[model samples]
Target: MAADHTPLTRRQALAALTGAVLMPLADPAAGSVRHERHFLFGSPVDVMLRHAPESPGDAALASVMRGLQHIHAQWNAWKPGELGRINQAFREGRSARVTPALLATIRSAARLERASAGLFNPGIGGAVRAWGFHDDVMRDGARPAAATLAAWRDAAPSLAQIEMRGDRVASRNPRLQLDFGAYAKGVAIDRALDEFAARGQGDALVNLGGNLGAMGATGWQIGIRDPFGEGLLASLATQGREAVVTSGSYERFRMLDGERCTHILDPSIAAPAQGLVSVTVLHRSAALADAAATALLVAGPLRWREVAQRMGVTQVLAVGPDGRGIASGALAARLQFASRDWRGRIATV
Candidate 1:
């Protein structure tokens, strides 16, 4: 899920519980070891792997990191070869055969795009890059001009323009450059969790920069940060593995004319969302949760609860611009509202 803060836009949140069994095979050469590694993927990835005392977990950790390296090699847009491949297909005006892994991701993107009625469009790659969000290209005092935003939106495609055949995929709109920034972490976390499960690792937690998932029968307790406070607003003690995502206007933004603008743009208008400071959604899949949170971000306060209810998302918390907000009915059942004032909490069916 997303952090409840300003200035720290991309903070990761992992839902971890107590009493989960993490038994690693023992090794004679060393005591319990936790291997930590940092690598560059679509974005920066920080991975942590732990083993029992005296367990040979380094090798296994290395193997996991190697798999992640492969993922970056194919997915990293900055990589010359990968860029060339995508560019070449666009230049040729032909559909390129995307790897199964990539196709699966796009398929999920397509689903979210449709489900959210274009609110959560993956076709925002151009807009994202134009805003200098890719390759860590943050520009000082940089904001897209109205004309630039119009052009980018015009050039962007809906997910329908993307076609997947077998393992090969093609974009009908050559201008459509796919960016999984919103959902890749969920996919990566799922990948890592699968790897842990294959080795019979019990109760493992995989947190890819805050997109968290788990394996085995153990429940993971995740903290949902307080948007305006120092500690967690609430914690979820869940039995099954799920994807938790947050979209907050506080994450990435610039103060222009004494006003704050965030990175979560409205694709239809190509402008920053206004009102409703932030939103967090808990769902069964990371990709779904990621895309759904964006949808809610765009829906704003007036219609957020209505849309969320229609989508069957029971656990949603919105922090309002006036510091007055409401939690979803399902979420309210689990967590108490701090504000007892009649103005703060409003529930509608």
Candidate 2:
């Protein structure tokens, strides 16, 4: 999920969490350790691996990053890519041919909409762009006007209306634009983990922006971003084969008409969702956690728990508009709340 806030890289967040940089891994030899950084999907993709220098870990990481680039090329919203072509086809009321991977992602997103009970909607790409989130070219003072936002918000039916058959996808709705930024990181991480495993990777941490996955390790620490202030609100341990992701309204935003506007648009109202400070979700599937976090962010205080349940998500922590820390029973059991009591008592969901 996109936010208007300046997102912290995993390294930055971990530094604040542990009073040092990143997770305390089973420190490999300096020559054997590899931490590669790259610009993928307009966000930082970080991979830390514990493999000997002479091994193929370097090449494996390179291949994984390249795979992510290829995926971004297909579905990225901003540039002239396969997703752009698909949007054009939708505009023309024609079917667009998609790779098996793209088709699968589209179908998966559609299922997410259903599974989340319409809480997750990729069809808001048009409204998101209108709100000036489609491009990171950063038009500082530019944002959609009330009228434009309304028009785009009402322009299309929900994602449930899109029709897909085999590898062909079609959308007759004029405002039906798809932006997979919310889950792309997690999907990429899953892909990377699959690649690493095939190449006999050792313990590793795959972090894309704030969406992270850890494998071949135990009790790795993660810090939940305190959306309201500095430092983290809590630290938690990750189970093997787990992914953690957080979404906040301020993560990606610009000042519109002298007002702070974020990328987390509400599909129902075609406006920015309010009242939620942040939402963090953890699950085994990075992709699912990514999308579910966004949905729960939009769900905010009242409906977040219900959405989490619908998504089969038992681990969640949410900051409400009132600045209270709310978490699911499962998450609360595992979380160690930071001593910053100013953030308030933990409220169970």
User: Which is the leading candidate under lDDT?
Assistant: 2
**Candidate topping TM-score:** 2
The backbone clash count of each candidate, in order, is: 11, 9
Question: Using Cα atoms with residue i matched to residue i, what is each candidate's TM-score against the true structure?
Answer: 0.76, 0.87
Task: Please provide, for model 1 over 204-269, each residue's C-alpha lDDT reduced to its tens digit, 9 standing for 90 to 100.
Answer: 555554455554354554555555544344455444566566677765666544556677777788
Q: On a 0 to 100 scale, what is the lDDT of residue 30 in model 2?
A: 28
Q: Given candidate 1, what's the lDDT at residue 312?
A: 61
Can you give the lDDT of residue 136 in candidate 1?
54
Q: Candidate 2 — which residues are off by over 4 angstroms?
A: 1-32, 51-53, 137-143, 340-344
* Candidate 2 per-residue lDDT over residues 239-279, each given as its tens digit: 77788888888677778778887788777788778878788
For model 2, what is the alpha-carbon lDDT of residue 232? 66
